[model samples]
Target chain A: MKLNERSVAHYALSNSPADHMGFLRTWGGPGTPPTPSGTGRRCWFVLKGNLLFSFESREGRAPLGLVVLEGCTVELAEAPVPEEFAFAICFDAPGVRPHLLAADGPAAQEAWVKALSRASFGYMRLVVRELESQLHDARQSLALHRHSSWKAIPSRCKPQAPDHLSRGLENGYALSRDCSSIGLAEEGGSRPAGSGLAECELQGPTNLLLGRGQSPVSPETSCFSTLHDWYGQEILKLRQGWLQRARGSQPECEEQDRP
Target chain B: MRYNEKELQALSRQPAELAAELGMRGPKKGSVVKRRLVKLVVNFLFYFRTDEAEPVGALLLEHCRITQEEPSGFSISFIEDPERKYHFECCSEEQCQEWMGALRRASYEFMRRSLIFYRNEIQKMTGKVGMGHGSGRGWLVAWLTLCCPPHRTPWSSSAYRKRPGSS
Candidate 1:
């Protein structure tokens, strides 16, 4: 009969009497955790499905109790392998070591393997939990970005400098308006200076409100040649108005006022 | 030829080995492969470079089929060299296209969720949380480049389909 490829070893406590009892004494020992000696190795058997085992030995030591399981096929390789046994020593209470020092024989070794296999499942669960938590946090951050308000966008544009005005022109914002201030620039530098005018130019009257800057061409104007020039003049007019208002309000500004 | 329903089911059950066979490896040896399986529904294209300063590798799927289409196709491709070219084509016979579409959608959703998780992990690691520079944006960009085409082709009304000239 051909060996089934998918068939896996299912471990049971009753199958191996000596191994089961040895595990209880070694791993289930009272008041202390199991620890391997410097000369010994540690082995774990996955009991739920396949008896997949993982073994690690300390430095300068040989591997012991190494076994393979695949669907009722159990084989143990010859020991005294060139690998050392090392285990992290954890103390539970005052002077209480969690090392299994008593499980030295083959039966005890088998039990230890089974116990380690069970513990591995727990470890996998913990790792999965951590991954889930990480995923949850990421979703929250994405939500925040998606729902952020337009006012929250980094304006990069400030009223303080001409460099920002140039950058704003490149980014497609030709005009920006606030309650007391207005800004205007040419979308493309190629357009002639007097051909186009923006609505902000007519702040007092005859205002042509360009549709929200959705497209490359200004919605109110069909002549692309005159677009920039017209818009630039309107901007100059708004600046002149602000300058005139400033002069009128200043107490010491009368000497320099235009005749 | 394309995989059928039964074949896809079998493949899903063996993703770990399949992923390894396809050159995907975990960060550590003997570690369990944790990536979600993503199937390519429609023919997909991906371009990436091993490093930002390197040239790009172009991968094309001529007639790719996936298991689903809801989550989109979530996949990772590693390129050793920028100029290397790879192709994976599948037939659109029978239910192959249908399955591929479904797989593609499912993968997109999975990737969307995974990216969110990845971003959060990056923020936590950097200790400068939020959606700014410290927010795994770089990692996300890298991940997207590995998973999909880096740049979108501008719509052109050319007579023939053109492949970008090799650098």
Candidate 2:
């Protein structure tokens, strides 16, 4: 069929609400419309709630598929026969002429079918490839989160410690100061000469800090306090590291020349 | 698949009865379903950006059946692009009703993120452009209005239907 010589026919049918079984029962059936019979022409019946038919030359087939559902308007060159099935929209029309199949022969028809099938297949393959790329990107993002070093800190740090330890580190420089103080306190004191006890006020009898401390005011008392502080600082550093790594991993945009 | 008006209406009605139908009835279930729907909608917007350079904020209704352990769920996956194919799925009747509500929330967040990111980029670009006082503001405002609807004060929701007879 020549592109301009071909025409489209549209019919809007309404099915009884009482007869409605389901979408499949109403719209899905075999007797809807026959596929096109000749060369250089194509017929597409899009079974949206209403059937829309485009009888165009082969060139217009693509634009039909690309049509947006909203602001959806169809122009029919002729009226179509109403069918007995459920409510439907029918379009029988000629689309854009198939330029690729300009030479008319049995061999051309066969080649056209083959080409159409190959083109459809290629389109589907492109879709699948794009989806695979997306899935790959999602997997890579999840993997980056999984293999990160910050994942270790929570496990290495005492579980009994407050969650605030991690939060404090991210917000301020106080955590680093606390770590330095603890290191200083631990180095300043030694065990007593005769009692085999730590001579420093901050050091407990067992030489362990935090829960074991005897006096709240002792310099040794600051041991647990210092460790708590340092622990928070370490967590902050790890979080910052993750943030930096994430930022660095992002793809760099090409620089445009300034006018 | 193309859905009819009745089917669309049925889908819209589902979320309200979702908790009741699942025997998971509770007041909070409505909100939970709504929140999930919103998340799905936001995800759809991101998918939309994959193909088109200009943002065309339009909704689509394409239905698909999703099987779960307890019962088979019906969902309509909205598509913005068939190529580069970004879409949001509103699975289950409850989701259909809640999806648009969720989309609004998602759009707000997306706009916020875009504003923050663009603001930073503008600052960087300005530094490279020799740091004139007003050099970056024009571009920043232009980008912000395009990406973030909330920044466009006159065109905001409060002003949306204020024209005569709009209501």
Candidate 3:
């Protein structure tokens, strides 16, 4: 298949942080002259996510070889030379030889093997999904805890804004606790506007505030609305309990003094 | 830069996350929309001739932007050249949204950012929640070590080889 070579090469040379990097002795790989003897050539190898690129030297501007570390196995293998701390990246494809590489020490060899083994797009996605579910569970429990704690306090001592209880569930920004403040109104007013959607995109991690952004393809209901409704249910249940208590104590205060 | 095309070809044959015969057009000027079997395998979007088993071209979803086009269509352009977009026409608006969402989440960088965000959130939460709530922490940290041996995680080597999500 015709791959986007220009973009691929540009990605290789991009300023993104390298996952791992070191000089490794290579043998029987693409762009390297094969040797009958076991004396492999030494080159600088950099691991960036799933792509493994090799450079001529530490300062080499261009990459010599690119290996997409997918559908492959990284195994500790016997090197051509003795005590070389070698590992091989073996692919399942027929007629394609495993790329043999040797690290400087046992530590480096183990590190390279670990990085290369986990360097696949699927593995990364798996971890992200796992964490996503965990965060969801955490938020659920936190909301439950907040509800119970809010119940313990007397209705007379209740906070001015019952809405703060729901808004506090949000992670990235601090919602205004003062119900009558202009800040809270501005913040609440902006949420449903179409322009607010861009600020809420979870596409890039550079904007940490957008981490809790709703998935664009999800149903029209924002997570904020879902969360609001969820907490609103808790508030409703609490309100009913408080109303019964207020009615039993003093019916006169029901409308004017009830929290 | 030299890479093994055979390895990538083998990957293209693996089960896809999504597969459909969509109206596709290349970034080239005057390119016409052609019926192509597009397969999303991991982070690569491979497009094949309707009748062929092998793919004609593969676009790496990394560093690429997926934008929704008008009327049941979407275009994918790279960060390198924003104007050069590979347009795709879906049969329905729902399908277009599905394609765009999948394509948006298809990049390694996007996955990485998500992982980091979740990792940080989980870490911050574990401190507050404590004990049993942090069970996922072990798996996150041990992901590298867990995949060290031949024992594969669900999305690891064996899973890729198995090609689970063919549709």
Candidate 4:
């Protein structure tokens, strides 16, 4: 197949952050098979995303060998040489020999194995998607809290929350636009009916509250339990505000509301 | 750079993320659009003859731009040479948008950026919440620093230095 070798090489030489980098004794490259004697050339290996590039040395600009870490499994293996920390990146492809590599110590060996194993495009996507959903949940809950509080006091200092929240959403929209613009909207639309109650509660006043920071898009984590606890604290504050208001004393609600 | 083509060929044989017989055109001079089975697998976009099991070519989606062309088409061009583009024509505008979105997200760099962005936002939210409550941020930060120290390559004061540009 006609591979984009030039661009791949450029990416290897680029200054993008290397996921893992260390010296490794490599046995197989291209037509070479793993030698039974375990003797191999030690090269500086840099793992960039899913591509693993081996240089002639640490300062070598050009890579001698490139291994795309897809459709492969990393396993601990016995090195041909005794006392050497070794691992093998094995691929199930026919005629493709396993790349036997040895690290300096046990820690390095374990680290390499872990890094290589997780260095697939699919793994990264799964994590991103998880975080995306988590961020969505966070926003939904925050909107719900704001709605309840706004209803309690109809004419107070309008907390600058919808603006801030929409700023974050704007950033998110921009970031998602590069990949899939419709993805965020689709996610928002497909949310369960329970959150739709929150949506219904948020619409009236928040719809009129113009977001100031609606600049072009950007990008969150999965902290559901912690978020729930945080929102629980918010509920407490809301209850306190209601109690104070019932006593004919309007406390500075905005101070407690600022996030 | 020497890499095993057989390995990539094996990868192309794996189940695809999206596969369709689309009209493809190379960046070569006077290249005309032709029907090809384009399959996206991991970060590689492999194009093959409809009848062939093996791919005719593969494009690594890293450091590349997927720009939507007018009238149900899109083009992919690498950072190295933006002018040279591999164009694909979809059946409809919706199909073209779908292909463009898939191609844009098919890069490892995109996934990496998304990861970093999510991590940052998560940290901000967690820190805000953990102001009164203690957090595991220390461990997370330590782990992140160990795994992904920004701008720092592996070697530092090692006694090994090679001439640059040597292969």
The ten-residue window of minimal lDDT in model 4 chain B covers: B154-163
Candidate 4 positional error at A50, Å: 1.1
Off by over 4 Å in 1: A1-6, A9-119, A149-259, B1-167
What does the lDDT come to for candidate 4? 0.60
Give one digit per residue, the lDDT tens place, for model 4 in A138-227. Answer: 454554455564343211112332223232232222121111111222232333322211111111111111121221111122234454
Clashing pairs in 4: A171-A218, A174-A217
Query: A162-223 in candidate 1: lDDT tens per residue?
Result: 23222322211111111111112232333322112211222211112211223211233423
Rank by DockQ, descending? 4, 3, 1, 2
Q: Which is the better candidate, 1 or 3, if ranked by lDDT?
A: 3
- Please give, for residues A1-259, the per-residue lDDT of candidate 3 as tens digits: 6988778777878876577889999885544554323778789998877789998899888888888887676666767787687777777678767888999887788668766766765445434533443454455445545566434332212121112212221110111111111112223232222111112122222222232345411223324447555434434553344344334535332221211
Name the DockQ score for candidate 3: 0.27
Whose lDDT is higher: candidate 2's or candidate 4's?
A: 4
The two-chain DockQ for each candidate, comma-separated, is: 0.03, 0.02, 0.27, 0.28
lDDT of 2 by residue, A32-52 (tens): 334322222333322221122
Please write out the lDDT profile of model 2 over residues B29-65, one tens digit for every residue: 2322221221122112211133332222223212211
Docking class of 4: acceptable
Interface RMSD of 2: 23.4
Q: lDDT per residue, candidate 4, B1-167, as tens digits?
A: 88888988988886676789999999999999999999988789999999888889999998999998878899999898999999999999878866776676677776666555555665575443222221222222244344443333222111112212323
If both were scored by DockQ, which would come out higher, candidate 1 or candidate 3? Answer: 3
